[model samples]
Target: MSNRVLMKGNEIIGEAAIRAGCKLFFGYPITPSTEIIEYLAKNLPKAGGTVLQAEDEIGAINMCYGAACTGTRVMTASSSPGISLKQEGISYCAAAELPVVLVNVNRTGPGLGGLGPTQSDYFQSTKGGGHGDYRLIVLAPSKAQELYDFTLEAFDLAEKYRNPVLILTDGFLGQMMEPVELKEKPTSPEVDKSWVVDGARGREKRIIASYSLTNEIGEANNLRWEAKFNGIKEKEQRWEEFYADDAEYLLVSYGTTGRISKSVVLNARKKGIKLGLIRPITLWPFPEKAFIPYKNKIKGIVTVELNTGQMIEDVKLAMDCCVPIYLYRRQGGMLPTETEILEFLEKQFKLSTEEV
Candidate 1:
């Protein structure tokens, strides 16, 4: 097959999952993200994979969890409301240490939102959306190409950590069409499946569940998982930076907003206002180190988001400073244009707004 093709973002993500050796997929149909399930249903079977249109979001996620427990690569995708419905299943996957790929094409709001792109789910996906002290590896892709590339990366990260991984995309990326360079079919690794359930045919039986009767045992399990997360945080942080080495002002963002912020940085630089951008590819083990070198040099920082100010808090926490952090956001499916973002930056940094 050719390496490059023009396709919808959601469809490309489905193809990327298949190429990543994902053989089992379970998802409920949801707007803006339905194309992914639709594509997988039509194509996965031909690739020797199974696609099940589960009864609901919960059923789909649980099915994914089961497949992951058997050491089979599995995936599920949904929009904002549907993802909320799958939260309990997601937490179960975390507790059971199942490696599953969960994708969320976010739309608007707290409930029954419209099919417009939004990043309001930032807090939900990154900061222990489900109950218990758990974390999911989160990836935010800005373009259709990253959407395709990140889907493949998500499976690898999931198995590497033996935990659920999330591709926190938005409706704009899901619905937009672009040319993407498809990855070559991945070669499966020599993975050890001895830990998986194989019906106890001669070997000892394997047990997997998230329940514990006593507090001591539960605390032990939690501590073990916490150690794994700390290791992951040390090894798996990924991000992108432009003009940050010497900038006086910095902009932090992810997903579509990050892409827009890049352009804003270029324009601001042309106007003689030294600006830089930090786009986090991994949201959970956030690219905290990306800010360390610039922490002392930057005069101020701005966070641009599709939501009001969810990610700004993380920026503050990561930088751990009181250096005049500001937020420019648009919610309820609205995206910030270059002019709006630049104007906000100029106003916050006290720069002249004219022609900048």
Candidate 2:
């Protein structure tokens, strides 16, 4: 029988990680994403895994770094503020080429933002959360099923690339409930300790350092990292598109906002609005090809974001302003409801009647 079950988004993330062969979870409790840690705390032990609640987000991510150095499948999750605290560790993870998974159930940012859904961290996550020439393999999930699937995918991508993979979500997606079918549990691959410091048996001590003193050596390392990122872009870009057959307008969004935008598109379709949606599953890669076909047909594009405006910039760059791209966003922890989006579309379409 399929392991299909109704679960909260956060719970599904933790459970799916276990099924994906994640054995170590280190995190501190935070709003929206705290359930992930709670779930792992109870279930990881039952699964013969380990879960540690560190003193703070910094400590939590550092613990993750330590566990990852031993070739353990490690993960850490937090909301916006906590994620900010973990940026230093994230940068270190990137520079050291450590395979790790990070989940950010984002809320409003730039300070002690409210514990409400917001996609304000788009730039922070996609452009690398900390200082350094690096990129996180960022995945954005619009539904609970995508959350579960992407958690598993994140583990594999992290190991395959030897880089950190971030599941960038929002508070709404994290707190929502939905039915999800857990994929078959992945077999844990035997750890290759050739590079890891696993007890240092019959091998020289391994160093997992991010710093290179020489400028030339650091530049060489950075170039190697860029080549890896290019490889990832060639192999890992992912996106979903719909209704471009004769669409005049395309909506670009991700995570919870993307799901809501899709609902708006469907509802507008019944009302004869020829609109389409491009959901970028991998936010960092930006799914540059997802909009190429619609470039000619797209008279205008609407970008719906939970933040004031972030991913819209990427959409604009991708489209090169060939089409009139409009931004519809709500910030300060407010969600853009379907009616609000439809109303915006009505204004854009210049509908004379109230049919919209």
Candidate 3:
């Protein structure tokens, strides 16, 4: 019997969260991302869950912060501007070491660009969009299947690290439809919840805080955060490679553009161009390991994006400037085409593009 069912990407995220035992969801309605909350509102109750449409994005994220402290699996969703509003609260969650999942159905933006697709949030997401010296476990899921799989993975990653996890997907993927097989729920490493404030009567008092009484304590707290980030860096960097093992040029991209970049690599191959792709699934732990093998082997690296080269910076950092890197992108929700990418590579790298 075929269990695969067609579903929208945004709704898949909500369904995955529910199956993962998420109890509370809080968010303000925003284009693209609005479908996530909408789906949850209508169906989460069937799983004994509660969905709250807060007054605004700010209220919603803060509500997540409050609920998470009680040892609850909490989440929220929003678009670019709405995510911008949730930044302060997000930073608070990171500092307090709360486990929560967040979804950003990216739209074009510096501010209210449109309900179009854009990966501009790459820099904002991976580089602490929230203030302070903290990092979210950023997962960039490329297609509808990933939108479901990574949402399940996001919750486990959040609880495993006792930190906030962000599922970074653009409007195009969120609004698109695809068939996905609902797999068995994933199992995560047990998190030590001794700090959870779920009635301290059973043990001693638990203070879940992001502050310190003295500067010395504050410095110590900051050091702890740095250590945790370093640990995550060493253990969590993840990426996907398409023919990068043997290629002269590599295309770097993630989310929807990542899937497009794959087609670019295939098309370039048909023309006898030695091209490949490296898609970073974990944007924060930035997948520096993936670039290490291709460092000196490839002539150069090309980054594709729906925004003005935000991820190019990370690609450069990953390659450490040892290998030349280039960027091809379009801003304000414009997606790049396979033809455009091939032309860029031929023009810039002077690669042989013999027509098959």
* Model 1 poorest 10 in a row by lDDT: 185-194
TM values, all candidates: 0.97, 0.95, 0.97
- Cα deviation at 46, candidate 1, in Å, is 0.5
Candidate 2 structure lDDT: 0.88
Backbone clashes in model 3, listed as residue pairs: none
| TM-score-best of 2 and 3 | 3
- Candidate 1 to truth, TM: 0.97
Q: Candidate 2, residue 44: CA error in Å?
A: 0.3
In candidate 1, residue 237 scores what lDDT? 92
Sorted by lDDT (best first), the order is: 1, 3, 2
Q: How large is the C-alpha RMSD of every model relative to the true structure? A: 1.5, 1.9, 1.3
| Clash count for each candidate, listed in order shown | 0, 0, 0
Q: Better model by lDDT, 1 or 3?
A: 1
What order do you get sorting by TM-score, best first? Answer: 3, 1, 2
* Per-residue lDDT of candidate 3, residues 1-356 (tens digit): 45688999999999999988899999999998988999999999998989999999999999999999998999999999999999999999999988989999989878788987898888889899988889999999998789888998888888888899999998899999999998878576688877888786858888888877899989998999899999999999989999887898999999898999999999988888889999999999999999888887989988988887888998898898988788899888777888998799788887655543
How do the residues 281-353 of candidate 1 rate in per-residue lDDT, one tens digit apiece? 9999888988888767789999999888998988998888758899999888888898888888888878874
- Which scores better on lDDT, 1 or 2? 1
- Weakest 10 consecutive residues, lDDT, candidate 3? 347-356
Model 1 residue runs over 4 Å out of place are 185-189, 353-356
